[model samples]
Target: MSAVTAPTKGTPAHRRSRARGPLLSKRLRMAGLYLAGAAVFLFSVFPVYWMVATAFKPVSEIFSGTPSLLPGTPTLEHFDRVINGELIPGVSFWRFFANSLTVTLASVLMGAVLSLLAAIAVARFRFRLRTAFIMVLLVIQMVPMEAMIISIFINFRQLQDATGVQMLGNLTGILIVYTAVSLPITIMMLRGFVAAVPKELEEAAAIDGAGNWTIFWRILMPLVAPGLVAASIFAFITAWNEFIVALTFLGRSTDYYTLPLTLSYYFGRYGTEWGSIMAASTLLTIPVMIFFLFVQRRMVSGLTMGAVKG
Candidate 1:
C-alpha cells in the first residue's frame, strides 16, 4: 500500500467531529431558549415600566421627540397634582380612592362568602339540577359583560321603580354587579378546593364528637382558605378597575365615582394631561400590588399543596 493512502471513514478525527456536532446543536438550542425567555420578559414588563417612568418624568421630557428609557431628570410635580389638585372641583383623589376601596372590598367579601357557600353545596350535597347549575355558570362566564349591560341596566331601573329604593346613581348597584359577575368563577375555583378535601376527614371529625359547624369551620374552611384568597384577588381587581359598569350605574354622580372614572378627568378638550394620567394609573396599581404581596405566601402554598391526593 502507498505511504500516503487516504484516511479511513472510521478514523478518530471523524468520530471527534461527530461528537462535537451534537454538542454544538445542543448549545444552539439552549441559546435560542434563553433569548426567547428574555424577549417575553421584556415584552411583559416594558409597559408597566414605561407607565411608572412617564409618571416621574417632567412634561418636557414626556413629550420629547426621542423618548429615553430612563428619565434624564425625574420630578414629582405630576404626583403632587394628582394627589392635591382639585380636578373635580370639590372631589379629591382620596374620595375616589375611598369609593373604589369600599366597592372593591365589599364585592370581594360578598363574592367570597357566597361562592364558598355555593361551592360547598355543589361539592358536598347533590341536589336536582346541580350539574345544570354548573353548566349555567360556565355559560354565564362565556357571555360577555358588555352584551348584558343594557338588560342589567334596565332591570336595575325597574327594580328601583318598583321598590322605591335608589339603586342607580350610587355604589350599591355597581357593588351588586361586581359581586354577581365574580361569583361564577369564584365558585368554580372553590368547588375544586372543597372537593379535594377527603370525606374521611369529615367522618373522622364527626367520630371525634365534632359537630357539622365545627368540622366545617375547623377542617374545611382552613384548607380552602388559600383558594378563597386567590378568588378574592380576582374579585377585588375586577371591581377596582371596572369602568363601564361604574360609569353607567353612577351616571353623573361624580361624588360616587370610582378611581377608574377619575382617569377620564385627565383627558380634556384641550389636550391630554399625560403626566397626571400616568401618575393616577400608578396610584391605581399600588393597592392591587399590595394586596397580592400580602397574600402571595398563601397563593404559593396553595399551588404546592394542590397536587396531593387523598
Candidate 2:
C-alpha cells in the first residue's frame, strides 16, 4: 500500500472546492427558499396593502391617469366622508356598527354555548341515535346554504305570521340564522376537543368531592378554552360578514345595515366612488384584525390540540 496522506492545512484547490461544495449549495438552497417565501408573502399581502394605500390617497390621485404605488398626499377625507355622511338616508355609521356588533356577539355567544354542550354530550355519553346525530350534522354541513335559504325564508315568514315575532324582517331573524348555520361545524370541531380531554380528570375531581358542574366548569372548560376561542372566532366572522342572509332579511331597512352593505352605496349608475369604497373597506377590516390579534394564539393552539386527539 502507498503511504497514507492526510489533507494538510494548505490543501489543493480541487480538494478545497470539493469540501466546500455542499456548504455552498446548502446556502444557495436556503437563499432560494427565502426568496420563494418572500414572493408568496408579497403576493398575498399586496391586495391588502393596495387597499389601505388607496384609502389614504386623495380623490385626485385615486382617479389620476397614471397609477402610483404611494399617495401624492395622504388625506382622511374619504374616511370622514364615510363616517360623517349617511350610508342610508337616515342611518349613521355608528348605528350600522352597533347593529353588526350586537348581531355578531349574540350569535357567537349563543352558538358557542350550544355547540360546547352538544359536543360534550356527543363525545362523552352513550345514548340512542348518537352516531345518527353525528351523521345528520355531517349531512347538513354538506348541504349548501343557497339550497335551503328559500325554504328557511318561507318557513320563517309563516312563523312570523303565526307568532307575530317579525322573524323575516329583523336582526333577530338573522341572528337565529347565523347561530344555526355555525352550529354544525362548531359542534364537529368541539367534539374533537371534548374527546381529547381525559375522563380521568373528571373522575378525579368527582373523587375529591367536586360535583358534575364544578368538574365541567373548573377542570374541563379551562382545558378546552382554546377550542372555545377558535369556535367563537369562526362564529364571529361568519355573523359579521354574512351578506346574502342579512340583505335578504333586512330588505330595504337601512337602519339595520352592516358594514358589508355599506360597500354597495359607493357604486352608482353615474360612476363608482373608488376612494370612499377603499376607505370603508379598510375600516371594515380593522375589527376583524383586532379580534384576530387577541385570539390568534388560542386559535392556533386549539386547532393543534384538537387535531392531536382527532
Candidate 3:
C-alpha cells in the first residue's frame, strides 16, 4: 500500500491563498463598481449643479473668462429678473408659469384617468383586436413626435376650419395634444399594473357583495395607486418640458406661452443673457424635482411591482 503523506503546513497556506484570490477579486470588482457609479453620478449631476451655480453668479462673474464652480458672491439678481422683470413685453413670469401649470396638471389628470380606465378595460376584458390595439400603442410610442408635428399642426388647423373654433394659438389645443401624446405610454404602463393584480381579489370583493364601482375603488385602486402615480409623473414631465408642440401650437400667441417659451426671450439678436437663462432653467427644474421627490417612493415601488406577474 502506498504510504499517505501527512498534510504539510504549506498545504493549508496553499488553500488559504486560493480562497483569498476570489475574495480579493470580489473586493476589487466591488471597488470598481463603486468608482463607476460615482463617476456616473457626477456626470449626471454636474450640469444641474453648474446651472444652479450660474443662476446665483452675478453678470460679471457669469461672463468671467475663468468660470468658477461656485459663485464667489452669490446673488439673486438673476432670480429677481426672472421673477419680477417682464421677459415678454406685457406678460409676467407668473402668466407663463400658470399656463404651464394648467396644461401640465390638466394633461396629467386627464391622462391618468383615461389611462387607468383604458388599462382596466384592456387587462380585465377579453375584447376583439385586443392584441392589435396593444401593438398599435407600442407603434405609436416608437414614432418620434418631430416626424408627426407637421401632420398634427395641419390636422389642428383643419379642425379649426371645420369647427370654426380656434384649435391653434390657444391652450385648449395644446392641452388636448399633451393629454393625447401621454396616453399611449401611460396606458401601456397601467395595463401591466392592472393585469398583475389577481382576479381573485375582485371575485372575493364581489362575493362580499361589493359592486363593480366599490370593488374598483376599494380593491383595485389602492393596489394600482403606485402605477397611476408613475404614469402621472411621465405625463407631467412630458407636458411641462414640451417645447416644440407648445411653440408650434401656441404660434405667436405670446399670452398663452408656457414656461419653456420664456427661455427664448433671453437669447437676443446680439447676445445671450446666460445668467437669466440659467436662472430660468434652474426654476424650470424645481417643480419637476419637487414632483419627483413627492412620488419617488410610489414610483420606485410601482416600477418594481409592475414587473412581477401575479
Candidate 4:
C-alpha cells in the first residue's frame, strides 16, 4: 500500500533550525537598552539619594571617615532639631516658613494675573512699540541678576525711603522683586498660549454680546489654563528658591528668612555642621518636589501644546 507516508522523516535538519537565536538577540538588545536607561537614572538620582541618606544619619556616623551608600542607623534627631528651633540658635523656622509662603503665594498670584492680562494684550491687540517692548524684555532678561542687584537694591531702598516702609527687608519688598523678575518671562510665555486660541472665537463671543472681561474669563482663560499652570510653577519655583536677592535684602532680618536662607544657620566659623546642613537641604527639596507634582499634568499638557502647528 502506500508504504506509507509514515510521517515524512525529512525533519531532523528542519527541527534544528536556529529561529530562537534571532529572538534572543532582540531580547538582548532590549535588555541593553533597559540597562543603559537604568544607569542614567541611577547616576542622576544618586546625589539626591545620598543627601537624604546623609540627612538621616546620626551626627557621629555622618562624620565617620568611611563613606556610606546607606546610613547604618537613621535618626530623626536633626529634623527634630529643626522642628524644635535648635537647628539655628536664634532663627525661627516657622516664622521663615510663613514669610516664604506669603511672599511666594502673593508674588505668583499677582504675577499670573498681571502677566496673563499683558500677554492677552500683546498677543491679540496691536499697539505702538509692541515688538520693541517684547525685545526689551528679552534684553532685560539677558542681563544677569548680579548686574541688576545693585540697581534693584538701590531702587528698593529709595522706595523704602519714600514710603517709610521696610522695602529692603520685608515680605512686600521680596514679593515686588519676585513679581518684577518673573513677569517678563511669564508674559512672553503666556503670549504664545493666548495667540494659539483663535481670535474668531473671541469675536464670536463679542458678537454674542459678551463683554471683554466675560469673554476673557469664560472663553480665553480656560483654553490657556495649561500655560497658566506652567507659568505659575516656573514663577513659584523661581521665587521660592531665590537665594541671592533674599540674602541681599533679607540678610538682616532672620524673621524674613526663606527655607534656603534657613540653611545658613548650619554654617559656623569653627566647622560646618554637615549633618544638619544635609537635613536642611533635604527639607528644602521637598517643597519643590511637591510643587512639581501639583503641576505635572498641566506641564505635560502645556508641552503638548507646541504640537499644534496652527
Candidate 5:
C-alpha cells in the first residue's frame, strides 16, 4: 500500500484472534474437567444417596415399579420398626450397636498401643531376625483372613475345649482375631512413619538432659502420633465391620450380634424388607462417619506437623 495504517487501540486483528483462540481453548478444557469431575462424583455418591432416600420411603414407594430419586412422602415408620425390636424380637438395635462399639474400641486401643511399641522397636533398634520379622509381617498381611478362618476357628475351639475360656459364642474371640489380623498392617504402616523420623531428634533430647523414657514419650511419641492415629482408624473400621469372624464366633446368640449381623435379619423367606434394611444400614454407617469427623482435622494436620515442624 501507498500509506501505512496505524495499529488501532484495540490491537491488530491477528493479535486479537490469536488471544481469543487460547482463551476459548482454556475455557473449553476447564469446562470439560468440571463436567468429568461432576459425573464421577454423581456416579460414586448415587448408591449412598439411594440408600438414604430408600430409608425414608414408605413400603409402597420402595416396592413401586419405578423408583424415585427422592421420597415423595418420607416416613419414620421404618426407623421405628428397626428401633422398636420389630426386626428381631427381644433384641434391641442398641444391643448390636453396643457390641460393635465395645469390640471396636477395645481392639483399636490395644492394637494401636502394641503396634506403636513394636514399630518403634523395629525402626530404631538392631536385633536378631529383624528382617525375617518384617518379612513375616508382610507375608501375614498377604494372606487373606478368609483363608485362615477355619484354622482360626479350630484353634479357638481347641483352646476353649482345653482351657474353657469361652472362645466361641463370645466377643473376646473375635476381638483377639481382629487385633491379630490388624496388627501386621498397622505395624508396617507405623514402621514407615517411625523410620521417617530422624534419630538425631532423640539424640538431641538426650544431649539436653532427657532420659530414655522421657525422650521416647515426649519427643518420639508426638512425632509418630499421626501414624498411630491412622493405624487406629484402620483397626477400628476392621473390628467394626468384621462379619465372618463375628458370625463364626458369636453363633446364634442375638445378644452377641454386631450391626452387620443384625442387618441379615431384615431379609426373610418371603421378601426383603428394603425400607427397614436401608434404615438400619443408615444407622450403622453413622458411627463411622462421626468417628472420622472427630479425628479428621488431627489426621490431616498431624502428618504435616509431625514430619515438617517436629
Candidate 6:
C-alpha cells in the first residue's frame, strides 16, 4: 500500500503567494508613492529654501569659493540697508509695500466677488448663449497673457487718451486689469464648485423661506469656502507678483511704484545690489507666507469635505 503525503505550508503555491502577496505588493506600491512625493516636494521647495538661505547670506559668503547650505556668518547689514533707504536715494520701501498691499488685496476682493456671482449665474441659470458664454471664457483663458498684452496696452492707452485719465500705470488701472485677467478662470472654477453642491439644498432653503442672500451667505458660501480661499490666494499671489504690467504701467511714475518696480529701481546699469535685493525679496515674501498659512486650513477643509461628501 502507498502512503498519501499531505501538502506542507511551504508548498510551491503557498510559497509563491507569500513571496508575492497582496500585503507585500501593497507595501511596495506605498513605498514608491512616498518616494515620488518626497522627490516632488524637494524639487518644489529647494528654490524657496535657497532664496531664504541667500537672503541671510553675507555678500562675502555668497561670492565665496565654497558654497554653504547655511549662512557661514549671518549679518543684518543687507536688511538694514533696505529698511533704512540707504541703498537708493528718495525710495520709500514702506510706500511701495503699501502699493503692493492695496493692489493685491483689492484685486483679490473684486475677483472673488465677481467670480462668485458669475459662477452662480452660470450654474443656476438656463439662459440663451449660456454655453457660448462658457466657451468664450474657456477660449479667453487659453490665450496667453503675453499675446493679449499688446492689445490690452493699446486699448488702455486709447482709453486714457480719450478720457484724459491715467489708466495704464495707476493703481486703479492695474487693479482693473488684474481683476479682469483673473475673472474668467475664477468664474469657471467656481461654476464647477457651485454645480457640485446639490440642488436640493438650495430648494430646501427656499422652502424654509430663506432669502437668496441668506441662503447664499449661510448655506452655499460655507460649502464653497475652500474654493473661494484657493481662488483668493491665486489672485493675491498673481497681483502681488505680477511684474510685466506693473512695469509697463508704473514705469513712468516712481511714486506709484509697487514692490517689484521698487526692486528694479534698486538695480543699476553699472552694478546690482544683490544683498539689498535679496533682503527686499525676503521681506516681500513674508505677507504671502502669512496669508497662505491663514487660509490653508480652510482650503484643505474645503477640498477634503468635497471629496468625502461627493
| Residue-wise C-alpha lDDT for candidate 2, range 217-271, written one tens digit per residue | 9999998887888888877877888888887777777777777865665454214
Taking every candidate in turn, the Cα RMSD to the unseen true structure, in Å, is 9.1, 7.7, 8.1, 9.6, 8.6, 8.4
Candidate 5, residues 1-310, lDDT tens digits: the string is: 1121344434454355446768677557557867999999999989889989999999999999999889999999989988875556777888888888988989899998889889988988999988999899889977988889999999999999999899989788988998898898788778878998898898898999999899878988898888888778867877887888987888777788888877865564224788888898899888778777756754454334346442
lDDT for model 1 comes to: 0.85
Error (Å) of candidate 3 at residue 41 is 2.4
Which residue pairs clash in candidate 5?
A: none
The weakest ten consecutive residues by lDDT in model 3 span 1-10
Worst 10 residues of 1 by lDDT: 1-10
In model 2, which runs have C-alpha deviations exceeding 4 angstroms? Answer: 1-25, 268-271, 293-310
Q: After superposition, how far is residue 175 of candidate 6 from its true place, in Å?
A: 1.0
Query: Candidate 1's residue-wise lDDT over 80-156, tens digit each?
Result: 99899865778898998899999999999999999999999999899999999999988997798898999999999
TM-score for each predicted model, relative to the true structure: 0.85, 0.85, 0.84, 0.82, 0.83, 0.78
Q: Which pairs clash inside model 2?
A: none
lDDT: worst 10-residue window of model 2: 1-10
Candidate 4 structure quality by residue, lDDT tens digits, 264-287: 645542146677777778887888
Clashes found in each candidate (C-alpha, N, C closer than 3 A): 0, 0, 0, 0, 0, 1
lDDT (CA) per prediction? 0.85, 0.81, 0.85, 0.79, 0.82, 0.78
lDDT of 5 at 83: 88
Candidate 3 residue runs with Cα over 4 Å from true position = 1-34, 268-271, 293-310
